[model samples]
Target: MTRVCFELRIKPELLDEYVARHSPVWPEMLAEIAAAGRRNYSLFVAEGGRLIGYYETDDDTAAQAYLTASPIAARWEAEMSRFFVGLEARPDEAATPLTEIFHLADQLAAASTTSAEGDAL
Candidate 1:
């Protein structure tokens, strides 16, 4: 699975409303996300309105394409766009993935492989 992360800024004045809106995302929107192949999704917000989102998918391209074509996703994004700052496109479509610098699980797996190799030597 590919882990994806993105950053966006929410309007400071609308941050509370944004969080409240997500407290219970629409059921159809949630189902559309699942149908698009995204899982383990989460969103984090900071005091300054910085928003970070993360999700994992087997194929990011396909997942994105699926969501781009989904009517539920379209409605959700349209409703959500107002809360975001400086986005010319829908929030979902505007999400540019953040680079992953580190992952503990990957490093641990590498360490295990190196140790096993040393044991054989």
Candidate 2:
């Protein structure tokens, strides 16, 4: 389960409309994502009109190829491009990968320890 995260700059005024459009994402688009092995997808908005999207995928290449080849996804991207910047050639534009430093989960009763003294201390 590889997790991916990226940011998109959205127009502040279009935030509401963007949320509304995504309230019930197109079934076909969801199907395409699932078909491509994408799971646990989510999006969030932060101050300064930054949109953060996250998802877990088994194969990034497959997921990306599926998205690029799916007509529904392509159309959706084009439609939503208006609400974002740097999306002029989107669907072709690649999403940047974020580095993962640490993760905490409720399933772990005891936290995993890490050496802080720089020598397995």
The model with the greatest TM-score is: 1
Every candidate's lDDT: 0.95, 0.77
After superposition, candidate 2 runs with Cα above 4 Å error:
105-121
Q: Candidate 1 has what TM-score?
A: 0.98
lDDT tens string, model 1, 94-121? 9767999999999999999999999999
> Taking the tens digit of each residue's C-alpha lDDT, what string does model 2 give over 25-73?
9888888888878899898998667888888988888888888888888
Candidate 1's C-alpha runs over 4 A off are none
Clashes of each: 0, 0
State which candidate has the highest lDDT.
Answer: 1
Q: For candidate 2, list the clashing residue pairs, or say none.
A: none
